[model samples]
Target: MTMLILFELPQVMMMMMRMGMLMMMTTTMMMRRMLLLLLLLLLSLLLLIMSQ
Candidate 1:
């Protein structure tokens, strides 16, 4: 049983690492989209102010 667990431990660790990487990728994508939206909003506001 000890040997079995030792073999499984590496697989579990690898799975956890993969999950973490995926989560980080998703969060970064969301942050990039939010930044783009904010930039667009700022640009539109500036344009409106200039037009006024």
Candidate 2:
């Protein structure tokens, strides 16, 4: 049992690492989407001002 647990340790660690990386990627994607939205809003505001 101990040997099996020891052998599986690396797999568990890898899974944890993958989960952490996926979380980081999702957060970054959210940030980028927010930034893009802000940019679009700014562009629309500028267009409205120009039309005035």
lDDT of 1 at 2: 100
Model 1 C-alpha lDDT per residue in residues 1-52, reported as the tens digit of each score: 9999999999999999999999999999999999999999999999999999
Whole-model lDDT values for every prediction:
1.00, 1.00
| Per-model TM-score on C-alpha atoms | 0.98, 0.76
- Candidate 1 stretches with Cα past 4 Å from truth are none
Residue pairs in candidate 2 whose N, alpha carbon or C atoms collide under 3 angstroms: none
Predicted candidate 2 versus true structure: per-residue lDDT over 3-38, tens digit per residue: 999999999999999999999999999999999999
lDDT of 1: 1.00
lDDT of model 1 at residue 34? 100
